[model samples]
Target: MTARRRWSTEEILDAAAELLRTSDAESFSVRKLAAALGTDSSSLYRHFRSKTELLRAVADRILLAAMDSYRPEGDWKQRIMSLAQRVREAFGQQPQLAAVWGRHASSGTGSRLVMEEILQALRASGLPDEEIPTRYHRIAVLLAALIAAEAGVSAITPEEYEQGMELFRVAVLGADPGRFPALSHFARDVRPLGADRHAAFEEILATQLAHIETAMRSR
Candidate 1:
């Protein structure tokens, strides 16, 4: 008789990470993950009792892998910014898992360690002891939102994006210039939203970090 295949937790997480990295977040499912692993969905239950649990595990692993080499150095704000960038890159690589991270609010060992690092940075920056959690939650949400936005951009086909741009151009040009002056003026130069998303994300994050510094000084 042929022996049944046994999957390790690490092996399953590796497959799940690959799926999150490549597949649209909405397309992720236990069946899909199982298929990717070349095993039946039921087999996964041996390691994870539910899809939610499995997804949380995947999310936790993704963040840890991203911050594996992270060591706090430089100014407090700079350290936080560095960690934030790592967070963004990690979540961006596995966009689908972003939702899972947010949904479960997973506190696996790796994620807890990440939280500690961020909180430590915030403490060093002089954020009030009581305000750290809120700050952390806000930053976490921002990172997740960015990842989701990146996933949305990836889902769009180039042809569709071009078609949308042409449609927008036609609408802006056809409208009365005086009534829609701003749109009319920018129509010729406006770029698609996803075209420069990475830059936009960096700008937004930079602004947020600046706010933290400002808050620290004002307090």
Candidate 2:
């Protein structure tokens, strides 16, 4: 008889991530994962202590994938943009994974390495040592909020998005000009910079980088 192949940690995480992409967070569970793996719950327990632990690993795995191909080769601003782009691409591919960003504190090697690159970029920007932490926090908050927005948009179907946009158009375009002059005028004719989400991400990132550049100039 042939011996059975034990599942590796990477294999387990890959399976878990795929499962998560198809299901909402509330619906994901250890039993379900074990079933998906064609193994007993006890077998999964040997690798992950609990469902929560498994999820954190899966989230970190996404981060690892985001940074796996990063090659640092540019000025501080360019480097920052490259790193941010990689992260955006990764989250865009698996926005479901972004749902766990704030909920889990990723202490994995991947998270640490990413942070290191970010910090290096900040340091290279010539910000004072005293200002680095706050600046870093701001970047973190900005990226988290943007990625969460992308994930929220991804979670909805195209029909739902179109329906919501139709409602928004009705509300904005139909507003009384006398009562809401600016909104009525602006909302009526404005075009998006690009595909709405992608454009917004690029605009916001550029604005943030511009702010950093201004700070560097001031000092």
Candidate 3:
């Protein structure tokens, strides 16, 4: 009798990640995955005890792939911007995975590695030791914002999204024009500020890092 070939954990994860990349997460069922892999769903259970665990594994795999491609040799601000852009591209490529990656607690090894790299870069740039945590907090916030923006952009139809942006502009302009004069004047152009969100996020990250560096040096 011939023995059945067992699938490795990495193989299962790769299959799951591909599923998420090509389709929505809603379509990622064990049965569907098994069918795609030409195996029984029971076989998958041997590798992943639950769907959540499998999803996390898939998220980790994709995130690590993203981190592997990050290469920055510049000042902390430039490095961070480059890193942020890589992250944005990664999540954009696999949007369903992005939603899962964004929600998971940053406790996994992959998550830790990414954070450690960011912290190391910041430390190398002369950010004070005491302020390192604050710098990371800012980076985390910017990362979360980028993921959220990408997710939002992926969820809406182009026409509906455009109409929604127009509605947002009207609402903002309707609010205290005297207090937000510039916003009111540019309301048409200010419609939710969705163009090149990753670039906008990079700017925000750079500004925050600069502010932190200045404050730490003063203190």
- After superposition, the stretches of candidate 3 with alpha carbons farther than 4 Å from their true spots are 1-5, 105-109, 155-186
Candidate 2: stretches off by over 4 Å: 1-6, 190-195
Report the Cα lDDT for candidate 1: 0.78
Worst 10 residues of 1 by lDDT: 147-156
Q: What is the lDDT of residue 169 in candidate 1?
A: 65
Query: Residue 155 of model 2: what lDDT?
Result: 74
The full ranking of all candidates by TM-score, starting with the best, is 2, 1, 3
Candidate 2 has a TM-score of 0.86
Q: lDDT (CA) for every model shown?
A: 0.78, 0.81, 0.75
Candidate 2 clash pair list: none
Write the residue-wise lDDT of candidate 1 on 13-67 in tens digits: 8888788766744677889988887889899898899878888888888778777
Best by TM-score: 2
Ranking by lDDT: 2, 1, 3
- Please provide, for model 3 over 107-137, each residue's C-alpha lDDT reduced to its tens digit, 9 standing for 90 to 100: 5566776787789888987877887888788
> What is the RMSD, in Å, between candidate 2 and the native fold over all Cα?
2.8
Query: Positional deviation of 62 in candidate 2, in angstroms?
Result: 1.7
Give, for candidate 2, the lowest lDDT window spanning 10 residues: 188-197
